[model samples]
Target: MAWTEAKLIAEAILEGFERHFRLFRETTAGAQARFEQADWPAVQVAARERIDFYDTRVGETVALLRREFHLRDPSDTLWRRVKVEYMRLLPQINQPELAETFYNSVFCRLFDRHYYNNSYIFVWPLISTEHLEAEVPIFRPYYPARDGFARVIARILRDAGFERRFRDMRRDIRCLLLAIRSRFPANRAIQQNFQIAVLCAPFFRNKGAYIIGKAINGADQIPFVVPILNDPEQGLYVDTLLTGVEDISNVFSFSRAYFMVDTEAPAAVVDFLRPLMPRKGKAELYTAIGFQKFGKAEFYRDFIKHLRYSSDEFMIAPGIRGMVMCVFTLPSFPYVFKIIKDRFPPPKEMTREQVKEKYQLVKMHDRVGRMADSWEYSHVAFPLDRFSPALLELLDAECAGSLERVGDQLIIKHLYIERRLSPLNLYLHSADDDDIRHAIGEYGDAIKQLAAANIFPGDFLFKNFGVTRHGRVVFYDYDELCYLTECNFRDIPEAPYPEMELSEETWYTAGPNDVFPEEFATFLLTDPRIRKVFRARHRELLDPDWWRARQASIRAGHLEDVFPYPVERRFRKDREEFPRRYPHLADG
Candidate 1:
């Protein structure tokens, strides 16, 4: 027979309860007999045996409903009753913030156990990691009803109840503190009135207009003190969110706009946002402005210009937050975009704030051009035409030939001379060459310099390094250019690449007692021709153990702790404690 609406709803509720029970059984090591044989009230009484984390509060609530309501399958009906009880008991928790945090955390954890395998641990996302996708903002593990219930409860709390509670707080000190501690910034105004309802509901629900008049008369302060924006059309209040957070670029808003700063953003990203703007005529002119400002000619002459502003080198462009994102721009030979920020900028320096604010204007302008992704504001792709000439000047001094730029990206074309001492030589190390060992040595030294400047080959394979036509060694593909501090050079082992043998997490083995050891020999000897070069210059790469030693030095001190943004003024406390905590590396 086809099920009625009530039966369908009941089945969903039953299934959700069954999943929770199965999860509990799995968690407690299949100890269903222990639970079944025990008194539900007594279980809760035993849980409160100590003020420790999980007592029988859940069981107590379950037992109360089963006995009072004459209910069977209490688990299926308990959630709604428990939410009511949770709402009722809010006035008593010592630290309501801590209590609410515990409630939400336990709620999610319990549901997670029902849906996810214990073997697969959840990974905490890092800074700027993506948030829930647009399509699915929240998940309802047990069925859609429970999810609907929570949202409805929150909405009720926000809409009709908060104002009266804030006004009459003096009548009940405990409930007043509970509201303060919950600190629900999002819906404070509405929740305040709800707090008053929670306080008087048990006794006053049936009381006539007199009690309600008294509650209103007792209210001296105006309600709705906190301003909350619930409208999606207005978007997030950027300034309020960004005020203190310095690392804004990696934030959800910025990363979602990644296509905005990358070479491959969708056309709709620009087109859809265009209508929101007031002025339309300036679109083409904006692109022309950026092209002229940081154009190819200007970039070459001021390649190292960013370094002069190193002390104040951070940018504060508008992002998701009211706080500006920190930025670092480099006009170096290859051109680089590094994000630099001081989490806390000096309040006295309004000028610095203004400069960063300009970046938002740049982003706004680029958004109109549809070049927002790779326009100068976001860092344009390398201008190969301007770059090739300077590179060739460096390489030709050591070669019989020169190099040329192809399009806007750097790529090798005239690969004729075999033994030429060009900078691009390292990439062609595997190619036949006279004095192959000597060629390898030049290529290796050049790579070492590039590595020092915070650039490393994406593929450390010997073939990836190459000699340019001008006889200089140059690195090309920078898609995975690692931060210099993150690379380990002296330890290039000959073993199969770690990525090949094991997963990324389990691959690296760091011995507790092992001092950093230089192991460049293993890498150099991975191939015969390279091995010959390693033996020839065994001193430079191996002696001081440049890679291992430098890495240890970088990791040992505050250098490793430098964030992408400028140092915050608030970190003075951390700085003071750093030397005391890390005595051995204190001087560093």
Candidate 2:
């Protein structure tokens, strides 16, 4: 057959996406070995590196096309044909959605948003993931009725296929049975149809593997997770039983590191998980399991659909304006668009690339449930009429380099999309006393957790943090983020003379990374009531010694436990007063 240009381009793009997915799957497959060997550091490194795989492949493919096709500003007719050719190639691949996203990315990079539509790019997916079938079964169903509930639970744990032995399989089984009896649908009729369906793969993430499944009885089903821990000497043991939508979704929370799950059929895996976490969008679930590029594609399509249906205008996000980022959001949507300013003001002294690297650093690190996940995009277009006048003016003035007005649409050159959150400072204004207390304590805990994960939010202002739907506090500002070890935690030196304190002159010399924890109380706790409340319980947060101690522990190779759920959610026997470096495991 003669090689048509459209067919050739489609083939090359498909080849590129396949190469990327294959490499992604191979690295994901290595998670099993990493988990079995208790090689957590390697797992963390690989998870971070894997995020770059899609972009690396895209760059390579783009270069090849540019070199071979001389593909700069191709005619719209050619790209329309290219799109048609790509759709023809979709039926053969397992992930046509991902391939179309790749083609869109390659097409956008070659030119502009002149043809950012179904004609030249995949503004909407060309394939349907509904009723997708995998060659192998996506999940294994176990009948507790036949095998006995306790025995089935035991069998499932064994079926996890870990190389190490369970420390106390019998005890773990008893625990699981007790939790199931208590939390499982209690109606007697429902119990007759009770069965557990477990995903066929272990979800590996920072020192733990979660057995994701759902317990069903008739039309009602309860999502559950069996989180297992590993110890070098003790092998593996069940940590706790996490059931219900809230607990299960927390395990797959966007605030934490992505899980490395080996799978041949991602669409099937997602289909199984969608019911388990209905509140989490398909994009988030895909991103959670390490296919972030496809997640981006999902997010973009949803965003475009929302924009098309809604009449709301985009306005500045409600908060103190950031010096480094100009953030805006539609009134109806729950996400915000953050664009790095063309020029940062004084004190925010970093190049645009430097600021981007900071966000990248956060993306790779274990967020420890304190940092929000950001989805990045380039050349994103929206109708010019959708933007409020003030927002348009702000974007023009502050983010000119990141914006391009192309005809009736406003195209953002580069931007980050993140879940919208109520800024802590703003939320505290209207919050009741109990809520204020909760936010304050959570804010302190958030900082401590980040330190435990070797991360430091350089700015300690309340505005840098935000309150989630669940009232949990999370850090979103990353302009001044750094590794905890990089900062020198210190106390403010005593003024040489008492008058020097009044003079506001240099009482001491501070290095670039010097952090005076004591001063956090000064500017951060401006409200006397809030200050008193914060100091009463979390005074340690303002202590330099405590900060230094946490830094030292991180430096000594300690990986502190970061639980997504609250202390009350942990099983009673597994609960400990103090945080541990490693998780509980069973010895042979």
Candidate 3:
């Protein structure tokens, strides 16, 4: 009777996962229609909606278990049997790793935090994904030697199955051939095995569809991405050709929303994509393709492996301390853990619930290549011995409500994990003149991009942003963030007299949502050198009229195009074209 009950519980969880995956695939399959019709607003809505699918399904399954067994917390003996039965059901599952995460989620909600291990949960994957492959091949191969180079490129585009026709196939093909020729090695050692292999499906995001693949000779191969854009009036055209690792990595950046691509075996797709972007882990690749739950599972397994190999204490991240959160990072790890403080100091007026809502808003809205994505975790633990004395002290002082000490382990009830970056304020402090100019340019770009996406970072202080290894400025603080549409952009009121302008007291009334852009330089760009560079390049940012115009455009549903690559990388940008845009590419 006990074994039968355990099997019933395990089967119920697996059935719930199946329903989620089916709906997930159906929702993803709609991207093609959304792209073909040039419905960007629909695309954005779909992206946000898909993120909620997992939690809804989990809730339903948990409710079912409660009604059936009145099981608030089951005995350890019974739950262990459930885990064993769950493993038996995974061999034939298409996404075994994903199913394991679903099981863990259901189990964790009902069980205590102390049992969150291999005994009652999937601390490690039950199935081996290392050798997984699709029932149907994920990619199609084309032999350039047999079909000729130009024909093969044309064939690649046709095989992608785009509904829209190319505006100028001949010109675009020539541009792609030119770009590929520029990347080929100088030595004349052409191999007979030269071919191009591209994924059969298009990677759809926002207003563009990408063709992902690699070009190979015998010993050398380079990854490539061809971005296909619908010009509405001009039809479809290839915008640019991105070759090599750095270019591909930027297109699949952590800051961007996940791409919608159909794949039965996501593990195989990730495996095939590993060599192209070797720096990205399986966790990020899975997340990029829209399997966020499995990505979280993969991240935990990787973290466990990292903890065993490295010997580093958790330390407070170096920067100006945050007002509303306590953050720490392991010295050997690339990510940071952030917890909301039990109390906020003076001038910081918001509840902890409001801060969490801001974080969730960032998660659902399009990041627009400016905001960083964070993983929310609850009841996570670490060994007491791994913490530095100072970090432990800070946590004890600030995060008492969110933390607990169980035996030798410190468990955090709620926290967020994100990729660590050098704070922009600290980065500019020691940077040279040239670096400062570049960073200032990126800082302005980040603000403009986020504004276009309707996100307003309420606080514009330098400390609220960070600089990535790629030299891009990204906003990570979200406590005061709100939609741009919600803000009231207005100019400061004129003083009745000159003396009034110099008064320290308020000269005019201000609302909660009102923002005066003209006052930004006074507080943020205090350094003379930083002020000069910013004013020269981004003068429009300080104009109230300019902000009003952007708000109007967003309200009118004008979706701005935020390119992944630079203007110099584009095949055509008004009068400037590729090769001519770059100093090195001028002669080519």
For candidate 3, list the clashing residue pairs, or say none. Answer: none
How many pairs of residues collide in model 1?
45
TM-score of each: 0.22, 0.93, 0.96
Write the residue-wise lDDT of candidate 2 on 1-588 in tens digits.
223887888889889989999999999989988887888678788988999998899999999888888463555467677778889988887777778888887887777566676778887886886656455587889998888877788789988878788877766776676566566455667566678899989999988888989988888888889988877787777888998888887788888899999887788889899988888889999999988888988998888789878998999999999999999999899999999998988977899999999999989899988999999988887899989999999999988888778789888888999999999999989888888789999998999899899899999888999988877899999999999899998888888778997875668889999988888887888887788889986899888899889888877777777877786666555423212411232211
10 residues in a row with least lDDT, candidate 3: 574-583
**In angstroms, how far off is 157's CA in candidate 3?**
0.5
How far is each candidate from the true structure, as Cα RMSD in Å? 27.3, 3.9, 2.9
Task: Using lDDT, give the best candidate's number.
Answer: 3
TM-score ranking from best candidate downward: 3, 2, 1
| Global fold similarity of model 1 (TM-score) | 0.22
What candidate 3 gets wrong by more than 4 Å, as runs, is 70-73, 185-188, 573-588
Task: Rank all candidate structures by their lDDT, best first, as comma-separated numbers.
Answer: 3, 2, 1
**Model 3: per-residue Cα lDDT over 471-520, one tens digit each:** 88999999989999899999988888889888788688888999999989
Shift of residue 465 alpha carbon in model 1, Å: 2.5
TM-score of 3: 0.96
